[model samples]
Target: MTQATAQTRAFVTGFIPAIALLATVAPAHADLKICNRMSYVVEAAIGIDDKAATATRGWFRIDPAMCRVVLQGPLTADRILLNARALGVYGSSPIPQNGSDTLCIAPNDFVIAAARQCRQGQTAAPFTQITPTQADDGNQVAYLAEDSEYDDEQARLAGIQRLLVIAGYDAAPIDGVDGPKTQAALAAFLKSRGLSPEIVQSPNFFATMIDAVQAPSSTGLTWCNDTPHKVMAAVGTDDGKTVTSRGWYGIDPGKCLHPDVTGQPRQIFSFAEAVDADNRTIRLKDKPLNWGGATQLCTRESKFEINEQGDCGTRGLAATGFAAVDMSGGGKTLRFAMP
Candidate 1:
């Protein structure tokens, strides 16, 4: 998603427009920059196809309403690809803002000169080809927006709305505009934290909100990464009538996340695997490392919500083991470990 005014690029930060800095105060050399106009902080990877070869590098963390120069130096690529993912704060990874070209990426920050194949430790994801609007100074700029088509201010509000929902508040629309619903939710959130409403606009608000979302909740299920490596997890729920599954929530070491689930389900299912820095599933004792049980469900490599559990492979999904989560009491905690 790209948007810019005719002669100038539209963008972010308080009181100061990002484009102003680019136009008036840029470095001597031309560069590639991406501005976040989305509701969540995002980690972006770029794929450059120049000459006859392609390369991909990534995990550039851009906060809401912020911009980062991804590729420095003069541009040489005929084609550019992007795969921007919302931070893990949303529980299940949100559908990546990506493109058609499948490319290899590492779990950690990396530079892959040959982006075609996935070596042992790397994983592949579709990258969207982008044509950044070229500035007069020869720099290229791109924007990442949610479905709402947010501007800098709207993106910040939408980001707050998302975090509010994650923290168990009842914010609505998530469309950046401040309305009754958002105001009410904000008031409640501030009150619950025993914080002054003044803190809402402060720089520390996101930090406070992040802590709230990461903390355990009294309802639903939480997955904790107790392992040394990162763990990707999925959850499924059954209410007797229907069984739905979704997955690929990346949990960082020692942190916890609560996958968003709805309604009171009769059963809950869980599956997770520990992965090394390059996004490869770890192997131990010559076995694929994973945490699961006998029950199997359909899952794909990317972020997905599966409504059907049968004939997974035929539907272009992988059938993976899922253990029945014992939710006899209200909320439950599932820990992923190296074992």
Candidate 2:
């Protein structure tokens, strides 16, 4: 189905009750109304062409005899003309032919008429998509002339009331109902918050309130495990340390232990052949090279002797007889390695 056909079907299926209710209660002439028969409320207005009659949904009441409409919502006087179109009333449209011809009808009269018509298989006329008129005094005057065609001010008021609730303001529940109390409360809220006190334009006030409440905190580190699989240590000679006659040397275990240099210290002892915490013996020849010197002895140089059970005694090698001797004058390196 076409979009227009779909909309009409939806409106017929969905909105019959509200339209019916409106039809029953609205006065024929003085009471002008726009019933939001849809699931959502719509801002709207109503008027007749050539008649100064206008009715806004929640904000204004029209007196056809007086040729005047009293606005209770937050709309500027000028914008009211534009808002009337949404009420199914537009420039120079004749009064609805089916409704009562009372000189003045209550706002509810229009609502009830619309509702009754919609229920009895009447559909709103398809909207003619008119190009916006060129900016001319005549166009402007024509636009204003049609202002009385609908009750948009009331629709705007109803919308404002809904927005106020959504925005957390203490407004009355929307019942397609309006009164002095509702108007007074809205006026107070707008005045206190420095908004225009009128209903035609008050919807933005509530929108601003919602924004103010929500705007403050609208944008918001991670860790991972990096552990080692094995721990190792190394022993090497520095020029600053002393070397014994037996050529025994001690390197401090705590000073050079780190991931890059050596793994964590497993255990500490005096000789290259000492067993680690796991009870594995340190095999001197299999030990990886330490930072101090080359792993292999030079050609013709004696292989390094490592003492496994050496103690720092007055005579060291005589007690253990186990030491890695680098017969080359330069020192040999020792490190922890898998046996």
Candidate 3:
């Protein structure tokens, strides 16, 4: 099957919007609606505090140019907490989240009550506090748009880097800082696309790029680091017949990297090693600061991409245990998270 076909299947099986079909016109009833004006698919969660209990619910899939009434009926909560994530493998939710309120959310649909110290199987995702304006008709609408995309220089640069990543340019992480890696990636993208490098700063150019990179590609592998320290990752791919191993894709803390390789492979192997700012290997009570499994593949101390996977000694490469990844014969993303 094609990448598009695989993506459609994944969406059908995985994504479930918060609400059903949206009304053509805002309903006469007083309901809280979230309209996503951005170019990518978004998943939203809502937190309501009724004084009796504070509950957070989520995983509402909202597509581009669409709206959904996340909370039906009259807006009862005096203050509503909201959080949203870009519904994709890249996790590129560029919507500016403001406020200090935080909530617990699962990778899937969930409703959790205890906001603090989320129990087993749930991650703490920050939620933005939104004070919706009460309309004359007693309705509320929250528009998630990229109009005022960022309020700071760092955010602007990171936004650009995200677009570059979607457009198949491995610009480093969207770390909200314009570093050498980001600049180099931006320059390469501009040069290859035949666009002026200066246009990278233009809002109009940024909007256009967002539109172009909205749809994510289903091929290749993506590795995300959830640890606090920087991680160096190596991947081995098996196309059913032969296997190849590549190494040294440096990923910053809280960042992800999609190796600059193409095609859908049946099996993927990954091995990650983490280090601090001074390039010192981090160890917790003498345990190795790494993530790997039993699948062994060829690797070297330096950066290298080798075609053959066997005879590591003869080829002057060391054998490393890479965790075999189950792609399920399509696109997949593996996150290297801490315990």
Candidate 4:
């Protein structure tokens, strides 16, 4: 995900640890488990304190109805921290399950020290101190729950529905209850992927669905990050009538993401910039690594979808150039590469 270019650090004397908890009771051991009891598929980061020094690591993916052992071995940590966010495939980012302890994290999978303040190319976010219920003062479980309060089956179903929608299927009202719509969407997805109907019960189904949603389709706009660093992008559309701009889609190196651009807009525009591990715009000889064009559009430092095209500064938005795309063909793919 495109990390907001903000960073800060403050060591807290009181710390806590969080990991994915197991749905079923885990075997007692000196280990930690993270279980996903929420509706949304989430990725989590964690921090650990071993009485001497604190270390942070993560970007662990946990699907609904599932649990993973993120930390193995002796559980001697006095305090720990966790930060979790929904998958970006869902149009806008879902409000994260967070706490008040602000900590540093990298844009991608990482493991770093928690002592020094974050340096360049790093961003800081508030992490919640999660204490898993312990058993025999040994094994522990941390359950990830949300307001939805979905049970195991419901969370699994809802997670599937969420991914179906992102994959451009027509499943809605993700209430976790199975209905004809959910079934039809599943059938269609299976047929398209040449997957067997029985695969629906496969252990890797969610991961498979995740893979399907990120591939560049031949029918819409796609952004591919071919650079060494992470790239963030925005899109503008004109339907021969009203025009709109939206963005901040984070594209990791070597990955392709199809932004939610629905319907056939007469014209499409795009803008992108590559940033380093610290979230700073990468520069080559003082020039920032970027892609854009002559079509100017209003944007902001945060996530935005602006329509009013005039006097952007007056409206507290920065006007940025967006390049028009030649989508004369059915689908178009924009690739970002280093010079």
Candidate 5:
């Protein structure tokens, strides 16, 4: 009887045009329906090219053995694009995306047009392409069967890590790779909650972890190193009134680092720079392995704290883009997942 819902908005063809095929069989009352056959709660997004323009909509929550109407009324679009994710307590999407077509999506209800890039306050994510099946009732049906579940070992393990991080355990970035850090965190989590260690060896372990993390945590900013190299991270917080930035916290490979900052803020910003053991930048295609955002902030080379938000050059501090972290529904724990 537990029902959850996520809304995705669609833009009319007057905004952006679709690039795919047009629907050959358009029914007068055609609708788009999604059926969830998985054990976990899944949310879905869809893209449609209604012959004139292409627009997408989604994040509809479909519980196990349930079906949800994604698009109602006449079928207009010929081809469809979809993306689904298993929701976590902290808004961690552990479901493996299965497509290459990128689309722009907002964290909340949105109906954006001309979405080829990640605009301000929006993020670009990949979605799967699916063909709508013409039903006998003239509606479209899309099945989210168990076979579509990303049940790989690495994916399952990463799902557990994401849950652990949300539950106050420092599992870092929920990268689908088994490491010593993940193992230790998992063990500690099992013991602290009185969960039998044997559950770790079962297929239900991932589900168990997800259920346990429903309770919120009180932890602060944490950075997880998901790459092969060591990463140094910086953090910034704005408590609706003032801004404070701090950093140069080094985190080893496959490990997590919790900053000294305590209590939750309204917003958090993060910047990550990957380097070698001797503190040399690692570059791929001449670009340094780093993560940041469009929000310009003041930073320094060494461990430093900057209370002021402006006058970076004049004050002898370097300026960099600190990406805003979406804490997923104002959750207390803010984790900067570095890849």
Candidate 6:
């Protein structure tokens, strides 16, 4: 099989469903969308005061009109805290890269701060700080009551399976639980795309995968950001100095604007020599080439040739000569041609 096909297969084998549940419940509304924008999803908890409270399993919605924290879940407990760092809602600090030093904030601190502000009839802060010890406190663990409703794992599995299939993976039917078959398919797909299969199993896997697929191309030959207005050349002068310009011959007004010329058309020419910044004249590579001279060089050298309009051209040569025929402006440095 070809390399592309092999990688595609590997990506399909290692897929896994992401977890959507969190320990803390937020208010019910439409404006609040969960932002799990990180590369890794993490499990967290919410605590009210020093006590751990069980929360309902549902999404949070923040409504600017009502300005209230509405709770919608299996459990109707009014006093609670929310803990779901994976959603990027509540966290102590930015997630760490190589270690866990930044994941020190506890859910309890957030809950207490919210409660205190609410009771005092003051607006609650967006986030609050929690200590490591308070984060580990068992009292902050909330338990779901018998009446509390939660999302079915089976439904989640089905949704994940459907998404995988849509992403071009041939995964099995949705089962609430993860299985070796699903893992194999995920692995195949990740490998094909040049990503780590092991990371795909993590909570942030889907986020990372989406980022990679949506990233812009980085090839230097293409214009920046794939815009059509830009053009680039790899030509160099004979003195080992490379000249890159935005448009044809680095002479278009839109391509280059110097004090020397106002609106010069793009054209290529051969020069006898060029003057440097210190006013020293430097000889160019080829003799002053008219259309005939350029055509002659094109025939003599197997690699050297004249392109359209009889401009000197070279194939695989390290350097080239560039000249501007119009010396309209007084700038001496810009008037000369360089080899």
Q: Top model by TM-score, which number? A: 4
Q: What ordering of candidates by TM-score runs from best to worst?
A: 4, 1, 3, 5, 6, 2
Q: Model 4, clash count?
A: 13
Best by lDDT: 1
**Clash numbers, per candidate:** 2, 52, 2, 13, 5, 39
| lDDT (10s digit) by residue, model 6, range 121-228 | 122221222221111312222221111122334333443453344344556554435788767767766776687757744655545543432232221011111211
TM-score of each model, paired residue for residue: 0.75, 0.20, 0.42, 0.81, 0.39, 0.24
Estimate, for each residue in 235-335, the C-alpha lDDT of model 4 and write its tens digit: 89998887889866777788787777767899999999886655567778988889999998997766667877889999988889999999899888888
Candidate 5's C-alpha runs over 4 A off are 1-29, 90-95, 135-138, 148-212, 216-339
Model 4 Cα RMSD, 1 decimal: 5.3
Please tell me which model should have the higher TM-score, number 3 or number 6: 3
After superposition, the stretches of candidate 2 with alpha carbons farther than 4 Å from their true spots are: 1-151, 198-339
The residue pairs in collision within model 3 are: 17-61, 18-60
> For residues 115-199, could you state the per-residue lDDT of candidate 1 as single tens digits?
9987866666678777677666577787876666678898889889988876667787777889999999989888877899899
Candidate 5 per-residue C-alpha lDDT over 157-271 given as tens digits, one digit per residue, 9 for 90 to 100:
5556756765666677656567888889988888877988788777556556655553334445556666877666777888887788876555556656554444567888888
Across 250-308, the per-residue lDDT of candidate 3 in tens digits comes to 56666666654546567788888776533345678887688889987997654457787
Candidate 3 deviant stretches above 4 angstroms: 1-29, 91-98, 134-139, 147-339
Give model 2's clash tally: 52
**Residue pairs clashing, model 1:** 99-127, 99-128
Least accurate 10 contiguous residues by lDDT in model 2: 217-226
> How large is the C-alpha RMSD of every model relative to the true structure?
8.8, 37.5, 15.4, 5.3, 15.8, 24.0
lDDT of 6: 0.28
lDDT for 233 in candidate 6 is: 19
Sort all candidates by lDDT, best to worst. Answer: 1, 4, 3, 5, 6, 2
